[model samples]
Target: MHPDQSPLRARSAPRHVPPLLLDIDQMLDEFSRQAVRAEFRFDPDTPAVVTVEFLAERGPGVIWRIGRQLLHRGLTEMSGFSDVRMWPTLSGERPSSWLLLETQEMEALFELPTAELAEWLDATYRIIPDETELDGLDWDGFLLGLTGGPGVPGE
Candidate 1:
């Protein structure tokens, strides 16, 4: 969410990473918590794909389309790796996505950063272990860890 060029303008289609595709819920959750704890960081190749549309004519429409995609698809896109994937938002909150790997994960991928995003992560993310651990910790990562996907960025 780098805003050096722009201000309050974040309207884009959310990245699509299927949730059921992986089951590393706990790890992802903690990861997100750490990120939120750290604040939202920006990167060139972030797991979460963001779209920013701030116009009057087609703004509402694009927002709807992108927002829906973000909420539905983006929400689950990072389900296993990026902490953002584990974000908490209303179920089926299409047009408004949730979950994304925390700043830590983003930084792991991209090093260049600003202090503002870090503060954002610190304010938003919070860890919750008791709730999601029962689901077996989303084994998608272990198998994928071998493949070199989100489970392992540069394997």
Candidate 2:
């Protein structure tokens, strides 16, 4: 293994919070019920959507994790959207248009406010996807972070 690339030497999460992230703390307090949906897409321009709804309020935090595993299996087992690079986009301060294209699941859930379409295209997510089930999917983690708001846990 390279001296610079060891698992034990991995960088840590930033102590300073980023400015772009929505007030996740507020969302956690506003509501307990929550869910996440996924979508798969075949077309580079558009793709199929897949979703796995979850109930964080009904049980401990594990339900969300289980649902995530379910989503992974569901995408691998199904066909339709390409499962190439799915959720890695959200890590970016500003995701690429190419990244946004794969988010059929999120788009299905929440339409970009018509007013915000141009801005949404230009900046970061001041707004996010609603909630809807999609089919097939690429294996990207970008969509996973969208699981904030009413469903996700918080400070």
Query: Model 1: per-residue lDDT, tens digit, 10-68?
Result: 55323232121111111233345222121122222322222322223323411101122
lDDT of each: 0.30, 0.25
Model 2, position 64, has a per-residue lDDT of 10
Per-model TM-score on C-alpha atoms = 0.17, 0.15
Model 2, 1-155: lDDT tens per residue?
67778675565332221221111111122344123322221121121222212223445321111122222322223212442222221224442211112333532211111222223212211211222223234334335447543434452
Please report how far candidate 2 places residue 127 from its true position, in Å. 23
Best by TM-score: 1
TM-score, model 2 to reference: 0.15
